[model samples]
Target: MRIGELARRSGVSERSLRYYETQGLLQSERTSGGHRHYAESAVDRVIRIQTLYAAGLNSKKIAKLLPCMRDADGRPNEIATPTLVNELTTERDRIDRMITDLLRSRDVLDEVIDTAADGATTDPASLARRR
Candidate 1:
């Protein structure tokens, strides 16, 4: 497909697709007339790239991880280095901590709601004192 079709199918912008190509996260071929063509798998590739970006991995890190990903052919590909795995694990842990903290905050807000529903006018100073 053409770049525009790829972008539409992948839900990624055209500029991002071109940037991914430049970053070696994606590949494309040029036609005789110099128009860029992408394989059907490019849509999946773009989704994977976006996932990695959302996971806090930079393009350079993703480039390394890409070699570890394999096609349906079951061919062995390069594995992620221990260092990269460690970094990813640490980031996951941090995200987990943030989630836990947010949940605790939500619980506290729930308590405030209960108190308010009970006709308790929560004194700001009392809340600060509790904190």
Candidate 2:
């Protein structure tokens, strides 16, 4: 398919697809007139790229990570290693910490919201006091 079809199917923008190509996260062949052409599998590839990005992996990491992923046959590929596992573990740990911090922040915000809702105190000092 062409870039426009891939963009429409994947729900990603053409500019983003071009950027993904530049980042080596996606691939396309050139037509005789220099237009880009992608394989039918490009749709799935683009969706996987979006999934990894949503998981907090950057383009560079996804570039490396994409090759080792399981194919449609559901078998492991030949590219996984202990080093990569360690790096992925570290990324997971970072995400865990981020989640922890966000939950804590949300708890504080909840307290503030509740206090305000109760009309307990208009003063900043009263808001600072936790029940």
Best by the lDDT measure: 2
TM-score of each: 0.75, 0.80
Candidate 1 residue lDDT tens string, 13-72: 999999999999999999999989999888878998899898777899889888888754
lDDT of 2 at 74: 71
Tens digits of per-residue lDDT for model 2, 4-39:
999999999999999999999889999999989999
RMSD of 1: 5.9
RMSD of each: 5.9, 5.1
Clashing pairs in 1: none
Q: How many clashes show up per model? A: 0, 0
Residue 76 local lDDT, model 1 = 48
Best by TM-score: 2
Error of model 2, residue 1, in angstroms: 1.2
